[model samples]
Target: MLIIPAENAINWKRPPWVTLGLMMACVMVFLFYQGADDRKLDAAIEQYLDGNLLALEAPAYEDYLQREIRFEGDQQSVLELQEFQALREQDEQGWQAVTLLFDRDYYQYLQDNRDLIWSVAERNQWSEQRGAIEEQWISRMSAFQLGLVPSDLSLYTLITYQFLHGGWGHIIGNLLFLFLLGFTVERALGPGKFLVAYLVCGALSGLVFTGFSMGSQIPLVGASGSISGLMGMYVAIYGLQKIRFFYFLGVYFNYFRAPAIAMLPVWLGKEIYDYWFAGATGIAYMAHAGGLLAGAALVWLLGKSWLQVKEEFFEPEPEQQDEQFTRGYAQAMASVGRMEFDLARRQFEALRENYPDRTVLLEHLYQLAKLRPDLPEYRDLARTLMADAMNRRQPEQMLDVWNEYLSKGEAHHPLAVEDHNRVLFTSLKNHDLKAAEKAFERMRLKAEPDMVQEACRLLLAEFEKLQMEPKARHYRQLLRG
Candidate 1:
């Protein structure tokens, strides 16, 4: 059973190398080191099930069954002790009877001795299993050394335990979660801070688990603690923004989109419910819940930049200057309607100088250039805006100014030749061939000898790329002249 997020709630400026590196490390560790443990455990269990007495004689082999029955004991397993007695006292067929009983549906195993001890036979069987595991010290020694145990946790296991896993499924499930949410959190908080936060959260989650299961001897491993922290940060940063997720439960699978923050309650609720009712199923649900709380708290305490988060999740409103310029420009236009051209011109120029937003100022200048072309201020401002737009490589803005100039019937006006060439390049780049032709005409009429030759050469190159032979030939002839 897996729930995978489809997309991140935040976008990053660059690739998340830290997240990628962690994923690669997990894969390498699992492939080379952890896979061996999984294979050994599987083979040992299979051999034991086959009733091979020689297989059971392997050094510390009884430790596996002892650990399984101790931490993973249940009422059903207590009943299976009858068959174990029958096998030892009667025949190999008795072991076969118990093996068939073990094939029932998976049940959450309890650690309670009372639930597993109903009769003297069950009690003896449980005691024998516990003694056999304790007698063989070398069995699962590596796991015990690396894994985090609540009762006797070593200092190094705080970090090392997260890198270890009981099986391939455990490691892979955790890595999938880390990949999806880790990048989003890492992007929100930079790589340096994110790394620090992740480690701290995982340690804190372990401590939290220790507080609840203080006396338990079971060793906890896998990256769920750290990955859960990333999920917490993800919820904090994205909040109400909808994110997509894909979920699989055996053969039934589906994808859905929902608010990223909405998962917080659902995930927390499920963990809490499972921890309360599920009863020691070998899953560290409390660790996951702790990581969530720790991650969200860390993000809140560290303080994500509200502006940066909002930029990723929401659309920005219009700037203050735009609204102010619109209101002021309307007043200036009303003055022009009353034939107060001098007052209107004065107001427009004052507003243009006072307003810091170039976009709004350019727009006002365009309107003034159309209405009061006699004023040198209006025409001069238009030229400044056109040049600025060209330098900024803003084709739409240049077209706005050019169209305004043309709208006022200024066909023969002495605009700069460089400005004409800029408009030509911008128009063609925008795929406006008609505007490009108009700019070429203006460039030819106003350009000096040197400027004309440069323009012809540039246009020839551009037209050749566009595969327009006629236009290319026209520029070629111009270059020849």
Candidate 2:
């Protein structure tokens, strides 16, 4: 079956370095070290086969003795033996020569006197082939020394074995699970604690396998135990939040969303059943179960503070509301384009309460504000837009908002003093002395000393052009101040 997790809600301010580092380490070890070992094993096997061929071609009395005993166990062997006897009757000297050399169990004789046999074999040039075969078997067995064997438990193997995978399929499967679930749990417990949890859980898994698989000598490897621990930690941290999972059962494939905590029993139970009741498939299912239990218990013991951290990461799926907003926004724009103002305004008003942060809704509201400044939503949108304009340094947009809303007392106050200078200069350029006077007064209230002096000089020039000496003298005094 296939199961995959969708994106989680946790937004890290930076990349999850610990998870990325672990992934890089695994890839490096597999590519450089474990891959070289595989090539060595293949070469050793080929050498063993070559040596065995040489041994087969070199006929010894030992071969006849072994074949004679093997012949008693099978009908084909018995027929071959009968043919040999017929050859003996036809050639007495040849038969006597064979019998003299193969009268006893030469295998036992070789075991009792290997030195004596090797001396005779060396004279016949067969000793070098035997030595090559033995060397090949020793070289082929060396890779297993890196893995953790229950019968020969060591602290180094417990940790090292998890990083050594048996094959590409094994490494790929374990790393896939690690990437899917490791980042989420890391975000939940933080990077430092996540590292601790991973190593400790892996160690616990190795211990469980050692205890149950007692006398077995087969070595265990791979990161399944650690990855399964992260899976358990994910359940504990997410609590009741529903997470979407992709699944496949042979011919059938489907997806389902369920609470993270809900899958714990099903996952742990499956591991337990497979470990105890199912036929052996060379998988250490009990170790996976132990890791899960250890991880879950560790998180639970971290108390309410960690539980609250989990709650902080809970973000419900936004798919439904986001779709609704999309459709509503399109329909509202359509109504406006059709010149149906009332319907558009109503649609925009409803959208305002629920999705005020949406850019399109705010824009539509700004349009309505331009036509009907009396509406409260229009004024609210004006303030939002004015602030946004100020942030973006869009002076013309701010001037538009000030004239359409703030100057008309539609919006209460100037968002910034630098904005008023633009308005005053604009009004003076338009020859609207009355509007210029109003903006100058507003500017004096909040303008900086240097800015106020600059505005006073402009007013002095405009007033002097109208031939108003008293007002020009008043501006001269203001500039001097």
Candidate 3:
């Protein structure tokens, strides 16, 4: 029968590179999904302009218009007008009965109406000039575009509209929340799952906002709906952990701990309070509430997996079995500090018997032996400890013991390196010549002139030693070159 140790049971920690790649993949997916829809809308608009008015009603017209105007702004005026003109021309072509059904006056009204045309034109111009400024401002608040009636199940407005925002403060605030919470949640969920959570939260929030607002024309923007999901995950995972918060009043700073679960209620309560009493100025409380609910549901579903991971990787190891030996060793150190050598020696010897495999303790035993070298047992013990320390890779400690032995004029063995070098220099000094040779080889491989020149001195030294007249003379000429 075979039994595996508890420590080897599971791996809960993900590699940092894996986490980073997941983040990049999430960013790419978001970009591609958003881009694909935009391209589809653009193509539809183009086809409508190319005498296909029947195609106009087939697509989500308002959504495509909103996304185009929001993203392209004034820069897209010419394209927008072209599409509009094509739709008009296609209406005259009778491609669809609805196009012909509209009276000449109504059709002319759409064509001659400068207000709608200018509205689109101005939107296009404004978007082109201030796309960056607008994006920056809109990233802070909870926002969503109008969803379809009845089912309210749609993707275009729900996805792209979340990327739009109301103003600078809203965008900054939302991005700040995302930056703070996103990294932690992403690390926990992996990139793919985190992104799925984000999109779901945004879609849910949009659905709720559309239901409540109905005819409201306010453009929605920001990443707050998704950030609320991260907040929910934080609460679920670290419910028992106390969160430290700081507040400043004039020159004084106050600090306190709010139980992790309590922050959710506090946050929700504030949003409710602001929505009812403080006017519709700061936050989108309804969308936030919707996002919070979605997040809670997601956490409940995934909490068990997260908990298992946490338990496996993060628990502390139990204390060592030889507690008494460790305590005696510590006490011996304390006795040594007080210069009670005899007491220290007695405590150390007792520790040595219990922890015979611990080489660190052996070094301490060697030092104690040196202080009492008059005893033959002390000398024997020191040599045994010194040899054990060297074998265990405690080189510095071994060197210290070796120096003490040398000073006392006792029989001591030198390390291998002491034969070639006068005294044992650091590993670097011994390897310098070898390193230089490798560097010279690399330079010759690359055909570098400076490398060839540097190798001349090394070559001359080797030649002088071997008394190779021809090779020495050749290196001499190369050095001059």
Best by lDDT: 2
Q: Write the per-residue lDDT of candidate 2 for residues 1-481, one digit (tens) a residue.
A: 6555554643455566777777777888788777676556455446534444223322444354446567654343355445555655675433433332222233234445555545665534444653464355432443355677786788987777778787788888888788878878776667887887888878888888888888565677888888877877778776687877768889998779999778888889989989866654668898899888877776777736543344434433366568888888899889989989889989998987877666567667788766765556566677677666666666567567767776554354334575567668767777776667777887788788888888888989999999999989989998876
**CA lDDT of every candidate:** 0.68, 0.69, 0.53
- TM-score of every prediction relative to native: 0.54, 0.61, 0.40
Higher-ranked by lDDT: 1 or 3: 1
The sequence of per-residue lDDT tens digits that candidate 1 reaches over residues 192-306 is 7777888888898888888888866667788898888887878777668787778889999998998877887777788889988886477999999999888877767766453
**Model 1 misses residue 5 by how many Å?**
4.6
Q: Given candidate 3, what's the lDDT at residue 323? A: 65
Of models 2 and 3, which has the larger lDDT? 2
By lDDT, is 1 or 2 better? 2
